[model samples]
Target: MQVIINGEVHDLEGQILLSELLERLDLKPGRIAIERNLEIVPKANWASTTISDGDRIEIVHFVGGG
Candidate 1:
């Protein structure tokens, strides 16, 4: 399946939840915001949000710095 993640196209196998994808990308769940198909996914729903083929995903991370 092909999906666009953060402006890049990626080919993934099978379906995966948003949380799983975060882990695969080595990102911290608590510090990131996920948008799937132009809709923002709530944190509480991340675990149950399943990603399908041709879905567009955008992951944004919050960085702390002064």
Candidate 2:
């Protein structure tokens, strides 16, 4: 399947869940925010959010530096 991630296109395997994608990107669920197809996916739904073809995902990582 094909999905647009952070403005880039990627070819992924079958039924890729949002949590799985976060793992692949080396992201920690508690430290980042994920928006799928214009909707914010709650933390509880990360594991259940399945990404499909043509879905647009925006992943933002939070960093602390001051």
Candidate 3:
């Protein structure tokens, strides 16, 4: 399956949970926010949210510097 992540195309083997996707990408869930298919998916829902082919996902990482 192919999904658009942060404006780039990524090929995934099959539909997976948002949480799994994050882990596969080596992303820290606590420090990131996700927007899937133009809708903001709450962190609480990450484990249940399913990512499918042609889905659009936007991941924003939080950085503390101050």
Q: What is the C-alpha lDDT of each candidate?
A: 0.89, 0.89, 0.92
Worst 10 residues of 3 by lDDT: 25-34
* Per-prediction tally of clashes: 0, 0, 0
**What lDDT is obtained when candidate 2 is compared to the true structure?**
0.89
Runs of candidate 3 with Cα error greater than 4 angstroms are 63-66
**Candidate 1 error regions (>4 Å):** 63-66
Which clashing pairs does model 2 show? none
Question: Please, what is the TM-score per model?
Answer: 0.87, 0.86, 0.88
| TM-score winner between candidates 1 and 3 | 3
Model 3 over residues 1-66: C-alpha lDDT tens digits?
Answer: 999999999999967999999999998777678999999999999999999899999999867778
Q: What is the lDDT of candidate 3?
A: 0.92
Most accurate candidate by TM-score: 3
**lDDT ranking from best candidate downward:** 3, 2, 1
After the best TM-score superposition of candidate 1, give how far the Cα of residue 44 lies from its true spot, in angstroms. Answer: 0.5
Candidate 1 lDDT: 0.89
